[model samples]
Target: MVNKSRMNRVAAAMAVAALVSVALPGASAQAAATTPRIDLRVLVVDDGGSSVEAITAELRDTGVPYTRVQLGGSGRPVIDAAFLSDVVDGRPRAKYQGVVLPNENPFGEGSAEMAALVAYEAAYGIRQVDAYTWAHPGVGLEYTDSGGYSGQLDGTQAAVTAAGKAGPFGYLGGQVAFEDNSALVPESYGFMGRPRAGYTSYVDAPVGSGRASLVGEYTHDGRSELVVTFGYNQYQQQFRLLARGIVDWLTQGVHLGQSRSWFAVHVDDVFAPDARWNKELDCTPGDYACAGGEGKESTIRMSAADAQYAAQWQQAKDFKLDMLFNGGAGEEWKAENGGTDALTAQLVADRAKYRWLNHTYTHPFLGCIQDTTTVPWTCVKDASGAVTWMSRAEISAQIRDNVNWATSKGISVDRTELVTGEHSGLKTLPQQGQDNPNLAGALADNGVRWVGSDNSREPAQRPVGAAQTVPRHPMNVYYNTGTNAEMADEYNWLYTSRAQGGSGICEDNPATSTCLPAPLDTDTGYLEHIVPAEARTALRHVLANDPRPHYVHQSNLAEDRTLYPVLDRVLDTYRTLYAPNTPIVNQSMKEIGTELGRRAAWDKALAAGRVTAYRIGTAVTVKAPSGVLAPITAPNGTKKQLLLGTADFGTAYAGNRSAWTGPEPLQSSVTLRLPG
Candidate 1:
């Protein structure tokens, strides 16, 4: 009762690389034999002709056929949907699989092209990638006619950088420095991980739903030659792997839901205005009780004592510490020489638990304003009681500012990830993606290369994972998006079954409770809480594949000095690869985003009905039925198992006959084995 089709596809993918490695001498012929020879078409946007020729010369040597189309070159239409019309209309068979936009324009022309490309991607649903640039895409350029602000810099100097945004990524991947546009070409999102200067930070919000994320500022790394953000360049190869993994995800290279893994834990705050969520969230209501919490029965003062507890996180070796949510602006980010260095210490102590990441300064629910009615450990939202999100600039401030706070002061994530205040509101930044722009465009703009999250999808959902991430993507996708990504209290339909009027999660939430970031043990099965070991469990699944999944903590990349225990182990996963595939030497997210552009083309071709059959060696092929065209039912293991309330992801495990299940089909060489 199991299908091996997906397994076969994975095997084939491995074969493609195996072929090259084998031929490289001392490589495995079997690996090379399984690799499929693929001819790819490439597009070079805004390349000014010279770079296009350079790309052609370089890629052609790899045995992949290609075609280069420059949007910013002569005879090419501008970004007003002129050229894209032909491609999506299914007219002149667009041969390019991906587009690479690389340049250095202080006039901000690069940002315009990047924005246009993003728009085209959205209109056509075609993926676009911005290569390593001085700045993140759409930023450093002039504000758009619509007043949306596309340019990121203020002419000569970059007005913004991604130095602080590294917090979130740090929690999942290792730490890395972001590339600043000043040292590099200044293109947004093109060159993440470039060496950049760093600063110390100290911004903290109370634990609430209406705070902002702590971001970083970008500086330059003179040694590596590229402008860099903190912890970004520190782990360059991590991004190369990240790019590879993203490609795997886009090409269906890695089917999610195919494997069964553990839930990824998320440590964050609750929305309650009690002491726990007060100091940083509702301390300044200006009410008579402002000085005191809602009575002693429900008061949580972010006391200095918490720092002692947070320090223990370093030894929690149960799992990979795959992720760490900044949990709404607790009393930490704002920690200064205030009364209790204890709260300050605890704030930094949390990073010791796992890799630090960009959680946005103040951890804004992004829907509301902050309230500083109380002093020390008491902050609240505005009287309007309405929530608000930070503007693109504000969000950037949080990220950049925090990075400076953590790095300069000596406290931050190990790596960096791109996420949002609450997984639901992951903005494309400056409000672009909602208008149909490709999400990748923003990451490309900032040069963020590594995307890290480890979560499981609800039962019955198909598996969706990034292949290049190796040990990272052995299981599911949307690691931090929903309950599978992190636990949620909302109990949305995704967790319920349609027949039961929902995804079955609402039925499970303690039968009535509406709290998220659930406790370790919940009385209700439906409200099952996520566990800390969720990340570890997922790693084990990857290890099951080969006893040695490429495991890397989120922090190891940027600050190798801290991950002494795991550095050697992390490298061991690929130690056997021929030629010692040394890390891509600081591959930025922008570069990976560039590689993913081709993936968008493939998807567009399928969506536009232009591509029907993919002749995979004549025998292995993909073809939709006549007029009954639909994507092949590639069964990833998503639906193979039962839904156990996930941990950490802050998801509400609304139990239902539909969400829970039994064992799953094991197809990989590795299998999950729990130590009794």
Candidate 2:
């Protein structure tokens, strides 16, 4: 018999998933029609109110260009009748696409400024997004002052109404943070009765061919096509979404200036002591040492490696390279630098030169199997040393200890991400998605934003715990031998090739049966072994500007000799081959991962096909989802300079054919386009 119920359940789950992925829907006719625009900008009318700074800050961060008109500023026009008349008449000087009322009525209620705004809304159907509560009635909304509701709710959860989910407010349609202590309620608003005509429980109905979006019940007579939220202290993410959405709705589709790609290099094990694993060299078949049964030989000297790194730090300091520094090597570095105080001072001085990422103290294989049994990585109780995962507490301690250690040493470490010891926990091993659950929880609790993973797992940026997991290219270039026991021999064969000076192997080695002719230094090994591996790995993601974090260990700075060349060459090669013309942006793993996550959100919004874009001559009109900043990829395949709103709204031409213009607030629509 067919299990119809089971099939139905599966179908429902799929539908829910689909809905969550692409939440925005088409706008209703009753709501204001999408306003097309050449540039995206809003007029921020501030009377030096409390919310002005917060609103403007978000505006700046989210790339919403705005022209500030401080009502209380000296020499500014008072909220008088003349100003109202000019504003309502759509004076040539008032070239704005939209208006943002941050808090309270900039002008007192019933003032000419408030009346002017009302008239302006009537004359032009420009969108207005209000952050404060009291200004609702001034904009022609039927708001009962206080409406018998007033006070403070923080971190309140808000659910989007069914109507809201189907309307232009669908971008903010999910359950989000809501704070509304004082809200202007409509006289017709009732929570328990049969809903009123213009009431969606959250938003007031269309009054003047425009709708009012609200987090709480707010009055809207519809005189102005306004979106008002009587919320205070909203989550930054939610606030950003709301701000972008409002701009998109007002401008039709937002013209995100341009796109940018970022790349970074990671140097791990900077201060870590040379492990016993790195000293072995094997003679492969055809080498004279193969017959002597001397396959595994310890030949690397740690002191020489340390000296090279010490010298290289000067070059690193000079470059001011925004590189990721694995902090686990702090102790070793302290000892090498003479004392902990010196080490701390050195790191503190170099704070601006690099971003510190966690590499747990006494680094252990976070998830790698020690033996046949799947024991946790923190299995201190297990004498056999066969462990797979670390307990949640152990994982937490591992991360917290490293961060605390960094802090103690005056080294600021971003707790957001930790390059796991050997990239162990992030390995694509026994099965996909089979990660250490305890580690995930610990990371979430630590408020980490990103963690390192393997590029072979198709790493872009995926959510792991509460953080974005960004994996680097699998093929790595390091000072030490290959990771595993078997690879120790393979590492020797490659590291001591003719191109790498062909040294460090004895005659009659079991694997090669031959000895290397000369000793290969770290530089030679980098050229012969590491470069090719890195080149192959770079090819996979460099072109796409994917996060290809070229990782290296401490010893790679040198070999048996001092003053070696490895990391510099690696960086030079990456810059030359992967990003010749494109400027490389060396960001920390956390920054890169956070950007990836943001980009994903934008991509999702763009992919929804909800954006309506129209370009007329040099003018373009765009209607896009909120909380998204889409980059304008030129049709001619030009380098897209990011157009995130920095100052007042203006298009950044940057030699492109289009002559960009500043976005004007308080207007319904304008035309702008990329040059043909």
TM-score, per-candidate, Cα-based: 0.29, 0.46
**Whole-model Cα lDDT of every candidate shown, in order:** 0.29, 0.46
Q: Which stretches of candidate 2 lie over 4 Å from their true place?
A: 1-261, 274-349, 372-388, 431-433, 479-541, 560-582, 633-676
**RMSD to native, candidate 1:** 27.3
Q: Once model 1 is optimally superposed onto the true structure by TM-score, how far is the C-alpha of residue 111 displaced, in angstroms?
A: 62
Per-residue alpha-carbon lDDT of model 1 for 255-360, expressed as tens digits? 1111111223233321111221222222323323444544532322334443343344335423433333343344353443353444445455464455455545
Q: Which candidate is the best by TM-score?
A: 2
Model 1, CA-based lDDT: 0.29
Model 1 TM-score relative to the real fold = 0.29
What's the number of clashes in each of the models? 190, 60
Clashes of 2: 60
